[model samples]
Target: MSELVEIREDAPGGPAARALFDEYIELVRERLSLPADFEPPEHIFASADVFTGDGAAWLVIFDAAGEPIGCGGLRVLEPALGEIKRMFVSARARRGGHGRRLLRELERRAAAAGMERVRLLTTVVLHEACVLYATEGYREIDRIQPPAGPPEIWLEKPLYS
Candidate 1:
């Protein structure tokens, strides 16, 4: 089996990335059975904004064939706190260590940016993500029922000081 992986950081959010983002959004919407009128706002792409503005960094995993198989990113929420964002791996890519690779890259970038800690907000529906975070040294900070909809789980991990 040839090595089937690569990580990229300069990926931009043009038509291709936007299309992928939409596909991801559609999958989430279908899984959650969200209302038809519940389209996410443009600001939801703030993760991309942060990436472009240098306030965040994105890591994308590509298979040997040069197809994007997984992605994750980190946004600096405050001077010393980074927010992990948009972690996803295609179903076919699960259990292949892609997610973990993306996560480690995010952490490295956060540490390089001088962040002392990293955090992320996920929902109960994302059980796998919660498991990954917990396994990777993240601890629960709080749980909240936001005006948005579902119960939100917040987790944090300390980065290199």
Candidate 2:
């Protein structure tokens, strides 16, 4: 049966939100092939401060059973600009359009808050995510080669036409 999913705006540190964040961390570690003992940095973990600034928002999507299926956060990076972060869909709940829905809601929230554009960071290792961003109208704006790990790509989308 197709699951009924609902996206809710909530703080990153909330119970359900935290669970999704934990899952996302593990998935990222695996996708990036990091050591098992690696602990996520403060910015990558459940840091409420990151989503508390101007035009910022956090959203969690849950299935009909009330289990978190996906999550993402938007934070203002500068005037008229916002950044999307921590986007994830649980491995069990993917391919159900949850990621697209979560991303649309985040962009809607940003636009409603007067943001002119939104940007996100991703690496090639997250193939599905990069594809999703591309299909959602995001375009590669910049790329950076870190001292270690895969190169990072920054994508941007204008909130309005």
Best by TM-score: 2
TM-score for candidate 2: 0.91
lDDT for position 64 in model 1:
85
State each model's CA lDDT, in order.
0.76, 0.85
Model 1 over residues 19-116: C-alpha lDDT tens digits? 45666677678767887656665433454767654558877777888777777778888889988877787666778777887898889888988889
Misplaced by over 4 Å in model 2 are 42-46
In candidate 1, stretches whose alpha carbon ends up further than 4 angstroms from where it belongs are 1-3, 41-47, 53-55, 147-149
Q: What is the TM-score of each candidate against the true structure?
A: 0.85, 0.91
